[model samples]
Target: MIKFNQLRKVFDDGTVALDGVTIKVEQGEFVVVLGPSGSGKTTLLRSVNGLVSPTSGNVRVNDVEVCEQSLRMVRRKVGMIFQQFNLVGNLSVINNVLTGSFSTYNKWYSNLYIFSKELRIRALAVLDRVGLLDKAYQRTDELSGGQQQRVGIARALMQQPDVLLADEPIASLDPMIAYNILSLLREISAEDKITVLCSLHQVDFAMHFAQRIVGLSEGKVVMDEPQKDLTAEYIRKIYKTHDKGLFFGPESKPYSDDQLVTWSEYK
Candidate 1:
């Protein structure tokens, strides 16, 4: 449902975020982009909904090109979750979710932040889907970190998007909270048939939830394979370091709680 062709991005400072990166994802597939910091994961995700304009090459969603002319349509088809939650902290949880439906508003009514009854009902349903129905009337800032991220997810689902792009959505949360968020995302991808492209540095979460894993290093795709086929050597290459002592060899056992704790440092 998504395609990236020879995409390259060079910022004003001459830092290349993506270099000749090409990847394709099928509808309803849950894919994870695994890379250390500065590996272009964020840039790659942003390119999908026109948040980041590529210097060259192209990005297409559901056969529609993502560009200035088609940006509105592409954005309507895409939903984004941010690392920072990106909600209006003072707004009630339901109101925050209602913001996602703004794209569907008419030009005359878009500025009022006034939503239709149908939209409000839909928003309530989305909040319930994220397990926050009881907190819909509560202030967003008063919610816990994981609950706030759930609010973000509810907001994204308000778009009824065909594709969901989560840019390090769990980076700031504790390990258990992060697992809950990932589990919720996986459930949404499976039950809702929404294509999910989540960028993460955590290997265990990706392995547990993703059907496909795409690894990036520097600004290029270093490895793209099914989660079951990914190897420890390729993972090490993706991080570009051995000092973490993350893996011993191809035959190495699964990471223990201590190793998982060490892996958390990458975030």
Candidate 2:
């Protein structure tokens, strides 16, 4: 449902965030992007939803190119979850989720603090899905970190998106909370048939939750493999080589240069 071909993103400062990357994610598949800091993981995710335009090449979602003309429609079909739960601290939890429907609401009504009965019902249903229905009336700032992120997920679901983009969704939470968040995402992906492209820093989380793993290094794809075919040793090698200090101690493994597979093979 998503495709990137020879995608390259070079900033005005001549910093290349994405370098000749090409990838395709089929409908209903859960793909995890793994890379260290500055590896272009966020750039790749942003490109899909037109948040960041590519310097060269193209990005397509459900056959529609993510250009200026198609951006509004593209965003409607794509949902994003961030590392920091981007919620309005002063707004009620339900109101925050309701904001997702602003794009679809009538302009005159959109500015109003009150939402329609039907929209409120939909937002409540979504909050329930994320186990936050009880907190709907409470201010978002009063909630815990995990609860806030759940609100983020609920807000994204309010869009009823065909594809979900999670940029380090669990980075700030404790490991257990992170597991819960990812498990919820997995359930949503399966039950709704939503294609998910989630970027994560932890290899173990990627292995446990993703059907496929796409490894990136220095803005380039180094490995794309089915989770079943990905060994811990292989993951360690990717970190050891392209990621270096990104992984250390027991997580790092020793491997020779010949063991590293060519990116073209995955292509």
**What 10-residue stretch in candidate 1 is worst by lDDT?**
256-265
The lDDT, on a scale of 0 to 1, for candidate 1 is 0.89
Q: Count the clashes in each prediction.
A: 0, 0
- Cα RMSD of all models vs. native, in order, equals 4.1, 5.1
Give the per-residue lDDT of model 2 (tens digit) for 147-239.
999999999998899999999999999978998999999999999999999999776677678899998887888788996666545665456
lDDT of each: 0.89, 0.86
lDDT of 1 by residue, 44-163 (tens): 999999999999999999998899999999999899999999999998898899888888877456456678889999999999899999999999999999999999999999989999
Point to the candidate with the largest TM-score: 1
Most accurate candidate by lDDT:
1
Candidate 2 minimal-lDDT segment of 10 residues: 258-267
